[model samples]
Target: MRVTIDEDKCCGYAACLSVAEKVFDLAADNIAAVLVEHPQGELADQAREAAAACPTSAIILLDDTE
Candidate 1:
């Protein structure tokens, strides 16, 4: 699965980090960033949870093609 983050929508709440720090990082501006473009195995599930946990809905998950 591929993950993308909307920097403008991220509030730096660190929800994503809580779910998967390996796949997401909280920048100095507090916005969540994609540490890995494509996550697999357990990391994929964590990434999904992180996206769902985002209050701002900044994290977006796309299929392999996307």
Candidate 2:
């Protein structure tokens, strides 16, 4: 799966970072960004959780087939 964050929608709440620090990081602009293009196994689960946890729903997970 591919993880992405909509900068315009992100509020820098850092919930995603708290949920999956390995896959999400706060960029210079203080918004969350993807640390990996494709996360595998447990990391993938964490990424999904992070996306769901995002208050603004900024984090998005695009399935490989999508």
Candidate 3:
């Protein structure tokens, strides 16, 4: 799965980063920055958790599997 953040929608809650530190980071503006485009192994589930944890619905998860 691929994970991304909509900077405009981000409220800087840092929930995503908290859930998946290896997959996301907070920038200077407190917006979520994607550290990994496609999460593999256990990181994939972490990525999904991060997406679900976002209060502002800023995290976008794109499932590559069909």
Give the Cα error of residue 12 in candidate 1, in Å.
Answer: 0.5
Candidate 3 per-residue C-alpha lDDT over 23-57 given as tens digits, one digit per residue, 9 for 90 to 100: 99988988888988998988998988888888989
- Worst-scoring 10-residue span by lDDT in model 2: 28-37
Tens digit of per-residue lDDT, candidate 1, span 10-66: 888898998899999877787777999899999999999998899999999999987
- Give the clash total for candidate 1: 1
TM-score winner: 2
Model 3 CA deviation exceeding 4 Å by range: none
The TM-score measured for candidate 2 stands at 0.93
Among all windows of 10 consecutive residues in model 1, the one with the lowest summed lDDT is 25-34
Q: Give the deviation of candidate 1 from the true structure as CA RMSD.
A: 0.8
Residue pair clashes in candidate 3? none
Error of 1 at 13 (Å): 0.4
Each prediction's number of clashing residue pairs: 1, 0, 0
* Candidate 3 least-lDDT 10 residues: 57-66
**TM-score for candidate 1, residues paired by index:** 0.92
Write one digit per residue (lDDT tens) for candidate 2, span 1-66: 988888999988899989899999998889887898699999999998998889999988898987
